[model samples]
Target: MKKLYLLLVAVLAIGTATMAQSKKALQTAVIKTPTVQCDMCKKRIEAFLDKEDGVASAVVDYKRKTTKVSFYTDRTNIENIKTAIANVGYDADDVTANEETYNRLPKCCKKPEDGGGMKKQ
Candidate 1:
């Protein structure tokens, strides 16, 4: 019947649309940086990621000196996110901190090699 044919076509179209809309989800990398002695690092890192375009959420574990991020696959990617964090003076997995940004960290937040010697950055 024509009605059955139309319904089948509509269903196929919808299936295609749904598949196109479902962007691939990636289990992106985690970054571990020195969180130093307080909540400042956590606040700064989380706030930074919150404003980034692709980031869904960021969780900073101060005790472990690690940050776990969940992000969209389409709008942005891991490298861009890592660069954003590095721009703020924190080290992301693959991105190193710029000297200028690194030096700008608070005394307590400074990495061990920088002389503040609190811990790794």
Candidate 2:
């Protein structure tokens, strides 16, 4: 009985350590997409970020103008994610969209400042 108890404790300790380390390695960040105006913008950003290195997944909510991204800290970071979004032609947090990519985006995805994009609700 004592041997079984010790084994159980050892297993639990290993599980707890594994969970803690994985939690640190994986992180989720909510980034504001100030220029995200419609479904097209959401799809574009999500699709682009989904293929970025270390990004586990990306969810963009155009209505909220926010993007929630899951990534491995050891492989990438928040700054890289922001830049990835910018490269896709949408602003991420304080990072502005890449001007060339922005110009190439569809009319519905462009910022309202450009007299394009959907009207904000």
Alpha-carbon TM-score of each model against the true structure: 0.71, 0.80
Weakest 10 consecutive residues of candidate 1 by summed lDDT:
112-121
- lDDT (CA) for every model shown? 0.77, 0.90
Q: Give the TM-score of candidate 2.
A: 0.80
**Candidate 2 lDDT over residue span 1-121, tens digit each:** 9999999999999999999987889999999998998888888888888789999999998889899999999999999999999999888888988999999988888877798878557
Cα deviation of 73, candidate 1, in Å:
1.0
Off by over 4 Å in 2: 1-20, 119-121
